[model samples]
Target: MREFLIFSRTARTGGKINPKNLFQEGRLDIIRDFIVEAFFTANKKRSAIVHCFLYGQPNPPLHLTITSSAPVSIDRVKTATLLSDLISKKKKIRGCEMKKESIIEFLTKASKTKTIYLLDKKGKSIHETKILPNAIFCFADHLGFPRKEFKRISTISAETISLGKQTYFAYQALMLLQYFLDEKGID
Candidate 1:
């Protein structure tokens, strides 16, 4: 299955989220949008999974794993509600699982099986790279990955790839990447 790992430097690790104030509460709105993009298409859902690593105040390194296998329908509101419940209750809900894993730990295990690609502006063009069917695209929030962490990520053998010269939001990048894969019939 297609997988995505989003590193959010400012997303909250716990506590209830103010749906209306997602931007103030560590930009949870972006995380919500990412989940929506990962599963929804025009009228159907895609077969994919998205892992969100939140490193924000009060707590750090909160991992949210959202899979397309969720029984309930997903949207911006539902996604935000699910997140709030997951954070406040600290329990697994349907297709979404919560954990306290770091990015390094997650990548170390994922790299062993799935082809890992780090999305960066300075990397090689994605068009030239051979993306595997079980590829996992790794990216960061608007602030980007931490310098020390980025260095560590490179050492994990993740192939760096560039969507283009221009920068795109994490959700936008996922959409483009999904389209490209669909065109190539990768999954």
Candidate 2:
């Protein structure tokens, strides 16, 4: 199964943030489209795991993992509600809270079997990169990864990938990646 790990630097972890205002808040704005498209792009089952680092919080970041083929809601507003319930309460809302983990912890745990790829223009062309059967894709928010976060990710030896020379928006990049994967019969 294809898994997408998105890192939102400004997304709020309060679970109270309005989904409709996700774009206005400059937090989940760019990722909203990606989350919506990632699941629907493929006929096969796919998964999207968003790791949100709130603007200054002592607690852990919010991790939302949703299966594309599952019978759960995936709309923006419904997704917002699910996120709110997932982060605010311990109980699962319509099977939302299956896992709550940190990025570091998740990276270490998933590193064994899954090949992690970081999206960056300076990396190799995705068309030529040999993709593994079990792969996890990572992307930073529009604001981009800060120096510290980038350094940490670098230590993981995550291969950098680029769609082309031009820089595209987060959602556009996702679509391009999916399209490339589909062309390679990887989706």
Instruction: Please name the candidate that would achieve the greatest lDDT relative to the true structure.
Output: 1
- Residue 157 error, candidate 2, Å: 3.7
Q: What TM-score do all the candidates reach, one by one?
A: 0.94, 0.81
Question: For each candidate, C-alpha RMSD in Å?
Answer: 1.4, 3.0
Give the C-alpha miss distance for residue 147 in model 2, angstroms.
1.5
Worst 10 residues of 1 by lDDT: 70-79
Q: Summing lDDT over every window of 10 consecutive residues in candidate 2, give the lowest-scoring window.
A: 50-59
Which regions of candidate 2 fall more than 4 Å away from where they truly are?
A: 24-26, 42-58, 69-74, 98-100
Per-residue CA lDDT of model 2 for 92-128, tens digit only, reads 5543443445676677677787788888898899878
Error of 1 at 1 (Å): 1.6
Backbone clash pairs for candidate 1 read: none
TM-score of 1: 0.94
Q: Could you tell me the lDDT of residue 160 within candidate 1?
A: 91
Instruction: Give lDDT: candidate 1, residue 92.
Output: 68
